[model samples]
Target: MKVTQRAKWRYQQVRQARRQIRYKFKPFKHTRVTRRALAAMVQRVVDQSQRYTLRAHKTRQDEYKIVINGWPDAVQVTVGVHSLSFLVMQHADFCDFLLWPDCMPRRKHGQWRCFDTGCLASGPYHRLEDLLFNHLAEPFLEFLTKVPEQAQLMLYDMEGMHHACVEAVKPLKRLDRPEHPVVCWPLPAGSDIV
Candidate 1:
């Protein structure tokens, strides 16, 4: 093959690889294992009572599962307090947690778009910031303050991850919902959580 032709082919291959890479739904903050573990924990909390879905890194770096129990298959879960509690941990996993799309958003230009951004950021499942920064800190705390005491939450690493989770959920405690103390098992440091 000609050298120029070979270069062109290589370029195409690289682009294709990137496209494929971006399609995968791996949340940046928590490892794949972390997502899986959380899913299992949530399942245990609610059990398989309702016909629900669990999509780890459903689109990107935000792990979320919409669990709905008690229903007529029609009028059930509301997108407010339940979701607020449900995503308490998930919101902490990534900088931006998108509740919309079934997939995570890929990068556009230089930044990621996210569901929480109100279209300020683009997202099917995009990010507001990199996983680390968001994991370390984010703007979700205010929402956490509004939660009720009976809300059911599952924490994997409370002490270690508490800095992020607590801060993120703090604001939600003030939201209109009951708080449900959780059974937390902090992940061992450096373990391959995913």
Candidate 2:
């Protein structure tokens, strides 16, 4: 029987993951804690985060950016108002998504006054998942697969939202640019759940 290199590599990866899970989780098993205590700890962690949602109607049509973390290299991609126009910067980054401009068009007389969809529909914005898969997926997977996961992947946008959780997925009306963009963060255990 012959084993291909890919199969051998996968087997090794599975073994490594099991070993890491056992070693890392051992501490939690030894420590005895009540349900109330566990709840308190979770609450504390939730309190540390500033929670908010990024709205699709609020995103800038003129600009779209995605920031990836856990990579050794600094990576950022931005798509401007023009079609097929984009900028990729290495190592230049921002933690707050609120700093970006609000490109959401205002409604005037029941009609949207801003050109939000046109710009976003153009350029490389549509290929977001693809771009990340090509350039950043390896490192991201490595980060996820590593032992004692310490790094977190976050998405930020112009709406001052951070640690967003997606509650729904829907399609856009026209241009099919994107739809139902929402962001949410974990709240305290007993607090209002998003």
Best by TM-score: 1
lDDT of 1 by residue, 47-165 (tens): 32222222222333434333332211211111211122223233334222212122133334544434334334333223333321132112222222332333333333333343223
RMSD of each candidate relative to the true structure: 17.0, 24.6
User: Candidate 1: where is the Cα deviation over 4 Å?
Assistant: 1-104, 115-118, 121-140, 148-194
lDDT of each: 0.33, 0.30
lDDT, residue 121, model 1: 35
For every model shown, the clashing-pair count is 46, 5
lDDT of 2 by residue, 1-194 (tens): 35798899989999999887773112212122222322332233223323211111112433344332223222333433221111222223433221222232222333323344633322232222232222322222233233232222223333333222112223223423233232223222211233
TM-score per model over all chains: 0.20, 0.17
lDDT of 1 at 92: 35
Question: Runs in model 2 with CA error above 4 Å?
Answer: 1-66, 77-86, 90-104, 111-113, 116-194
